[model samples]
Target: MTAGTANAQRFREFKMPDVGEGLTEAEILKWYVQPGDTVTDGQVVCEVETAKAAVELPIPYDGVVHELRFGEGVTVDVGTAIISVDTDPGAGPAGAPAAAAAPEQAAAAEEEDAEPQGRQAVLVGYGAAPSSTKRRARKPQPGVPAQPEPVKAQLQAELNGRPAAVPTPAPVAPAAVPTPAPAAPVPPAARPVGAGAAGRPLAKPPVRKLAKDLGIDLSTVAPTGPDGIITRADVHAAAAPAAAAPVAPAEVPVAVAPAAAEPGIVDTAARERRVPVKGVRKATAQAMVASAFTAPHVTEFITVDVTRTMKLVQELKQDPDMAGLRVNPLLLVAKAFLVALKRHPEVNAAWDEARQEIVYKDYVNLGIAAATPRGLIVPNIKDAGGKTLPQLAAELGDLVATAREGKTSPAAMTGGTVTITNVGVFGVDTGTPILNPGESAILAFGAVKLQPWVHKGKVKARQVTTLALSFDHRLIDGELGSKLLADIAAILERPKRLITWS
Candidate 1:
């Protein structure tokens, strides 16, 4: 049989998988493939931004692209189909089979416990599908006229990027009804773009929320986003003039009406700019809040002279054995901290609230806090306690570089036993840092500056810096915390303690 007459085309729907632990949804940043484009298994079709990080999603099956369920910048929930593929395109038209098998049916098939017959291995876990809830429909209010069919057609045309034909109304006899006054014409700038049948403007959920919170009508806000979608910036720009307008006195009667007070208009006193919290920033904020509230924190500070450590850093930079390695104060600081942790094994632990136990760790997964354009992320090196100084420095370099590039994986940010945040890079002296959730402690490395010191009973200039260690009060008390901090400081001051202690 010829390929065209073999069988009807079969379609497969690719659902949005849960890329990270407990991630509900992700926003499609961009689509690399379009409809009719051929795609292979494991080929990345789009990039999505989740609460934790930006991740690229790969299509699991080979086929010609049939449809994109959602557009760019649209947030889709896990287990929801994002794209469709024509799996058996050689059979020509999908015809009756594709029509018979609706998206709902495909979703229903995926709900089974065991994998479906043709199911392919997903890159990440396919999360549980969201439960469907049915709601009662509201009846139309009395005295409200039904919308015209032609106007509804026009709205749909606008959504599809098509020019709609103007419909001519039939003439009525003069005696049938009294003549009504002509309605005011809407300004072109004030007109909504790509409106739905219900007259609601096209915008993302976040943008809609921002407009709602700022008391701005989305219809009045010009859409600058792709496909005539209203953006956050557009909403803010619409509210700007109203926000800048001068307020009138309560006693004074004004003839001209304010821009705000008009029906279906934007009105707000929002002086400060509002940014929607999402992606990395949103996750960081939530984690910090949980850590602060759940874990009782106690911060301890100590100032130390690190002249010898600084000199050793310069010496290591020139050494052949440590050649091509990142030899900085942070490198030394991390090594010293690791050595201190080795001496105080009890400090490298986590408080398991669920188990109601203080779990001590045999090895450390040291997390390094790196600040990026997206937000702050802490990507730790696995089994940091077992690595050599050169290996540690290499890992640190890679981790920081990856984090700054916004390519750090969610896996790298988990299983951290201890953390070190280098506030010194920002010229900060010290800070009471919050512990990373699940980790017992976080050490803040302060700026190293030259100051007058009594070296061998003589007044001389020496390198000085301060260190702050914040720990879980429940697991580590003042005595244990102080000893841990003191050990780290001693290693830095002598620079020989690393050799002796190790």
Candidate 2:
């Protein structure tokens, strides 16, 4: 290729794309590439923590790494140029010259003077809005002299590049304007500490917001993050003691004393810890709150002998068809729920408030709630109702594994028609689980324990577990909800019913 042609193969700026679900910004958690690193299309170049989850972003084109505009831990707005890559790797020294010749001051001035290009980034739909450079008017002091006419005009232009009103100074006698004495330097502890205090405690915006929400003072929280930064764990550690202690009434104040300094007596603060809710935890909290209040929830529980289902799980595991797939009581339970949904599709509907309609779905998007390092996320298997037992087992296994890895995509999380949360995995007996937003029902499976139960008029030890089904009362009445739960219980009680019911 010609020298001019090679040099013209410019560096492509990869702006931070909105991963999905209307996320506006993300914090760069880590970068997998640096300057001069060769990167291919579809290579995961960096990991970012969005408001929803930590997502690894892949490069869309092959190139040689040029620059990373923002560093790790910095929250970058969507459509902002994050990394630049030289598309033509062959133009080595020529490319280096352009980057090296670009002086920092010149770049800064150019950026300041440049108008919004209205360039579209990855993930098309809408371009980022033009950022305004609006500034607040500086308050005038009593004796401070006004800037000269030319300087004042220049300052006005720089503020917003528009003509602005400049306050002219009033004539005053030199003797009338007395010089004020120098103020005393304030001590750090004595200085007024507002939310935005100078030399403020280092914390991410999400962590700061979490501390604010939990009524935990960040200044008191110890910093454990790098560079003496206050992390989410640190904030949560500080809030733990307060959360565990008896909450004082709104009108009353209670005095809390640290435990005595005796060898065995540990201070409450020392023993306690606070965790700031963000990413998956924060999303789960908001979703649950919205699901609880918005939908009139009605939960029904049933305890049944799931010995037959458990046996079937074992049988499936040994079967040639299911040999490689994960075979567990959860797999059977999921299959049973899908079968029940098939029997009573009414319970598989969602309420469309805007349209004032009960939208019934013919297909099932079976959501399995998986607990990951981030928090609880329910990623679903699309068209699960049509999947066979082996198919369901495979999908369930994959869904859980993906969720555990925190790699479940936004698409996998959305459009869940119904959900199943297995609290049994945690050894919990049962729980009234809130329905996933937009879904009509959610089933909670509890721990299976050997319990004495009357089997054909004789008290026999059987594998028994409780099932809780919570549904939106506005869409599903108690009778329909009970029948659906009963159907699931009956299937588990007799695994053969799954064959007969279908």
Candidate 3:
């Protein structure tokens, strides 16, 4: 009969929804509301990130925030309660103990019934409660007997850094105990601490993966995490010694100079840092690797004088119709790429390996690669080939702005036929670019710099830039690739081509 008990009866817990596309878990990027803050129905409560994209989650009902179940940056499994709210605040405190006890009873009953029961419907996707939340009783092995309570208490006391009380033992006949066989000595360093009853080291899945990648043995790692769980830092600490160990005898002479001068003063390992790859960065890495090895890549490059294109960009900016639209060299480059795709529609096709057939696309979803703080993300403008220059400019502006703000949706990034990456903004000349996964070709637009060139049969300083095109060789022949690159360069060289071609 207290205020705490009254609020417990009115509390509603909100579980983490699937967000989209059957994602199993998401990292809590941020929280918008704190405990004691009143939130309305359909209020934005927090933002989370999945492998595909970052999404904001909204609370479905009105209530006063009771508690936040998870902190920022923690990856929580789907269907786990992430927050709790109290729907009624003015109720009198009565029968609080019984109300709270009811939930505990229900939870115990659910666990006792092992049959898979349907979970409460979620906002995004349907899923059964995860069985991993429950732990089954550990049964003793065939030969090993259970330790007596007194010995268990003594071990616990020692682990807690307290002197164990010695228990007086009754006299037993010596013949009753059998002599044990001699065992091989196990170094204290090799003994596995913080292990479960089954002798398996206590570490999370991500920590295990990290240990596997670093080739570090988990049993040898000391646990510093709560409840004797091995954490990522523990794994990294275990691997640091191996990485900083002395080099082999062949390279010992090379390291001797530094060793002799510093004499352990400089710790090279401390200068190194490791970051766990997750979210968008992790997905991008896996996709790039698959694309590079599975498809044969052929790159072709061309240099073009883009002085005319620069003039057009300036003209467009001054034009009344393009007043609010973003008009830059990249816009013209994107338009030029679309024009080239129109001339050679076959370049927009994808090689479907499973079907062993060329799937030629009718419309172009032109992907524009934008580098954000999260990493490189390419969000395409749908049906870009069919849109007017003004429409394309507007959509392109929104796409880039959304990407830079880290709000681009996953749907906006899929089903692309071709892509253009502008490396000019970074002041790079040009280099071979990789094709995005499932796309046929990618165009790299480089910096435009003044250079000496022959024009009108006279040497003059002209604005020039190099363009690199990388395509899937299995689908595009060298001749086709060359033509696509040439067309893009030609349009940029003579901006009049854009008007005439359309």
Whole-model lDDT for model 2 versus the true structure? Answer: 0.75
Steric clash pairs (candidate 2): 236-273, 236-274, 236-275, 237-273, 237-274
Give lDDT: candidate 2, residue 479: 93
Better of 2 and 3 by lDDT: 3
**lDDT (Cα, tens digit) per residue for candidate 2, span 1-502:** 5433454466788999988789887877778987889999999999987766678999987989876665565567899878888887774555222333433322222111112255411111111211254345565576665445767555634432235656565455486777453344344455323212234554544556657755678788876553344555676567656544543333323335545765675445544545555567777899999988899999999999998888888887799988889999998899899888889988888899999999998999999988888788888999999989888888888988888887788888889999999999899999989888899999999999999999999999999999999999999999999999999999999989889999
Clash numbers, per candidate: 0, 5, 0
Off by over 4 Å in 3: 1-11, 20-22, 88-266
Find the candidate with the highest TM-score and give its number. Answer: 2
Q: Write one digit per residue (lDDT tens) for candidate 3, span 287-354.
A: 89998998899999999999999999999999998989999999999999999989998899999889
**Candidate 3: global Cα-lDDT?**
0.77
Error of 1 at 489 (Å): 0.3
List the global CA lDDT of all models.
0.77, 0.75, 0.77
RMSD of 2: 12.4
Q: 367, model 3: CA deviation in Å?
A: 1.1
Q: Is candidate 1 or candidate 2 better by lDDT?
A: 1
What shift in Å separates residue 1 of candidate 1 from its native position after superposition? 18
